[model samples]
Target: MLLNDRVCVITGAASARGIGKATARLFATYGARIAVLDLDAGQAEEAARDIGPGHIGLACNVTDRAACDRAAEEIVARLGRIDVLVNNAGITQPLKIMEIAPENYDAVTDVNLRGTLYMSQAVIPGMRGQGSGAIVCMSSVSAQRGGGIFGGPHYSAAKGGVLGLAKAMARELGPDGIRVNSVTPGLIQTDITGGKLTPELKVEIAKGIPLGRLGVADDVAKACLFLASDLSAYITGAVIDVNGGMLI
Candidate 1:
């Protein structure tokens, strides 16, 4: 019961096989009331229901500051408190630098970088008032290594921005009793990577990893669980890499 009696909000959790949903499930298993936020209200609620009883799902376009504010308010109103927030709403593009149009850059950065900012902004006031909270922003191995197995340069830039933003937020929010951290997961097997790898390709990729396997969504979710719990109370402005030695 690491998160017993906690209330947590996770963005982009509607995707059944995604990291956000995995985190939601893990948090729920620990006795935290969970809110699954997604662009699609129905899907979000469905995901919540799948997590079990007493969880909620809401529609939130994290790119829109107003929407984020409203969603945060609704969650607090419904759940009474917010103990943790996971800014997991993000989008990635696999285009090369030469192929990145202005629109592509906007689409990539808006969801990954701006979304993290706006959502965290919406939740901070609540956390500040409570004087205790944890924020886990999702970064990527692409951000660290300058490229990825699939994501484009813009994706790297967006996730890299997330890392910087989380650190800054952690420094500023720590005094208020809020801890902020980022997770840089490597080549995770999720909807994002589904159908993109052949069995041979996966084996080749695994050879490069010390753990010899692509990361599962649960691997990252378990990391989020630790950060969201009191176990990480003293940690802030940290980047926990869940890459299984891909970056090493």
Candidate 2:
């Protein structure tokens, strides 16, 4: 019960096997009244119901500033205050550097980077009001390694920007009692990447990882839990790599 009665809002949390949803489920077990946010209202609400009563789901297009603002307002009005904000709404595309078009760049960067900015903006006021909060941004190993199996150059650039944003926000918000951090996960078996990685491919990828297996959603979720909870009370402006030693 590390997060007992905490009001946590997580974006892009409705997916069946996504890291966001995994985090939501794990957080709920620890006594958080969760706000599961997604682009689809029905899915978001359903995801909340699956967690149990008292928690709620919200429809939020992280790319839309107005939508993000509205969602934040409703959560505050209903849930009372925002204690944790997980900027997890993101998308990736596979394309080479030359293959990246203006629209491709916009689609990837807008969700991964712009959405992070907007959602954090939407919650900072409440966190400031409470004089305490935790904001966890979802970056990727792709950002650190310069390329990934699925993400294009644009994706790497977007996530790298996320790291910079989180560090800057952590510095600016530390005095306000807000801690900001980033989680960079490697080859997690989620809905987003599952469709692309075949059994044979997964085995091949696992061989490179020192853990001898590909990462699961919960691996990243556990890292997020540490960052979100008091376990990391003094930790901020940092990046936790849940890459199973892929980088090393």
Q: What is the lDDT of candidate 2?
A: 0.96
Each candidate: what lDDT? 0.95, 0.96
Query: For model 1, what is the error of residue 82's alpha carbon versus the real structure, in angstroms, after optimal superposition?
Result: 0.7
**Model 1, global lDDT:** 0.95
Q: Write the per-residue lDDT of candidate 2 for residues 180-214, one digit (tens) a residue.
A: 99999999999889998889999999999999999
Shift of residue 14 alpha carbon in model 1, Å: 0.7
TM-score of each: 0.99, 0.99
lDDT of 1 by residue, 36-130 (tens): 99999999999999999999999999999999999999988999999999999888888998999999999999999999999999999999998
Index of the highest-lDDT prediction: 2
Please report the TM-score between candidate 2 and the true structure.
0.99
